[model samples]
Target: MTTVVGIDPSLTAAGVSTIKHPRIAGNPNKPICATMGRQGSNADTITQTAIRIGDQTRRIWGSLPSSVQLVVIESPGRPNPNAPGRFAERATVYYRIVEQLALRRIPVVTVASKTVKKWATGSGDASKAEMVAAMRELWPAALIRNDNEADALALATMGAMQLGWLEPELPCHISPNVSWPKGVVRV
Candidate 1:
């Protein structure tokens, strides 16, 4: 079985999910779905947050079967100007995840945050609550307790659909209203 892993990285709370492609054609099974994080007050330092994020990621990777072929992660956009310092801290956590996966030689794919949101919900600017609701409607078995988990699963689903391992619930294009040229719908 080939598995695609999705990660929604953050220092406050991160989401991890996986979709396994079975030998036979059928629904892709999401055998992993969870969030990991320690409160900022608990960590108190950026370095501590990075350590916790790395440890959590390692634990999740260790639990997986060795058949994981691709890692799909959200692209951490430019830090908010109003919260640049805080952004750096969270960005560091995201970088740690990418670095660890790269060290393991796992192929990492970055899907934009907006793209993941649109892929999961119908709108690119969907709220966190909307994302949660959409994911629940799509994958009823997934216990998406928070937006992070929903994002992870959504990114994983996008990767699987892109790889042709699973059919997409919506058009694969990031833009829902995109007017593709004739016969150029798939991305």
Candidate 2:
């Protein structure tokens, strides 16, 4: 039973989803539980956000079962063309999470925003509403509210698909030989 935790890191409101292998036969990728965490608005500084995200990640990671084998985080896609440095803030937060995960010796993986979106909704440019709709279709009882949580859940689902954690509707083969260190896997 492998456990995978996915994160959509942000300075203001980091989103997270934890999934476990299904206990019943014929179903392997069902998530047993899920959660989300938001940094307090009082944490006005980027440094404070990083610290908060790190602390929250540590706490959540600690509470998981010893069987947890992988942690997947969503990497910021191409920086906003119009905003220029808009992604710098999120990148810093992602870096901090990666650093902390490495220190803990847990295997970490990263999936691009486009890749996760495409995998979830069949369109890399899918809107937040579309993503949320797709997630609801996948997990009818999932109680996801905001887009951040939906994105986090999508990242987790993509990670599970990549790791062959999910039983696909169509017969498919995922290569386990591909090497992924503590960072992003370019799809």
Candidate 3:
């Protein structure tokens, strides 16, 4: 089976999740949820963002499964004046990941922030804690470590639903909720 990757891209903690084979010889072969990320304070300088972008990109790239066919990433957040460089940092990681995957012809789909929230928790403005809680309720098997992972899990589950490998069972339409690639559809 192919892998569906979900990413909540960020320079600080880039949440990456994959719905692949199974966990620990999963006899029934039911796919499992796996998540990973590195959380740290935002960079303070241009040089810092530059350095961390490479590191974040590497981590994301390493986390991807061998047969990644679809990637669902949350749209980049608007720039925050307080952070100053937040927009550049985020947009860079988003572009690099897409660019890398594009080279291999992997289709990447982006979902709006509010759409991710609403689809996952029935509210477009759900809080980070709320997202985590809702995801845990949906897939308790996953060790949801943070909000980023929760968002990424939601995004991945959405992609999995698109491919029919997994179903979130939520009361939401995948195609209507997210902008699908050319001809992909839920099975």
Candidate with best TM-score: 3
lDDT of 1 at 148: 91
- TM-score quality measure for candidate 2: 0.71
Clashes of each: 0, 0, 0
Clashes in candidate 1: how many?
0
Error of 2 at 107 (Å): 1.6
True-vs-predicted CA distance for residue 149, candidate 3, Å? 0.6
Q: Flag clash pairs in model 2.
A: none
lDDT by residue (31-135, candidate 1, tens digit) is 468887666564357676567667765655564557777777887778898878767766766676778777877777777777778778767799999988988
How far in Å is the alpha carbon of 79 misplaced in model 1? 1.3
Q: Which ten residues in a row have the lowest lDDT in candidate 1?
A: 176-185
- Predicted candidate 2 versus true structure: per-residue lDDT over 32-127, tens digit per residue: 334545546543576765566667656555545666567778886668877554476677667767787778687887877776677677777989
Please report, as a residue range, the 10-residue window in candidate 3 with the lowest summed lDDT.
21-30
Alpha carbon deviation, residue 42, candidate 3 (Å)? 7.3
* Candidate 1 clash pair list: none
TM-score of 3: 0.86
Q: TM-scores, in order shown?
A: 0.79, 0.71, 0.86
Q: RMSD per prediction, one decimal?
A: 4.8, 4.9, 2.9
The local lDDT score (0 to 100) that residue 119 gets in candidate 2 is 69
Q: Which regions of candidate 1 fall more than 4 Å away from where they truly are?
A: 24-28, 42-65, 172-187
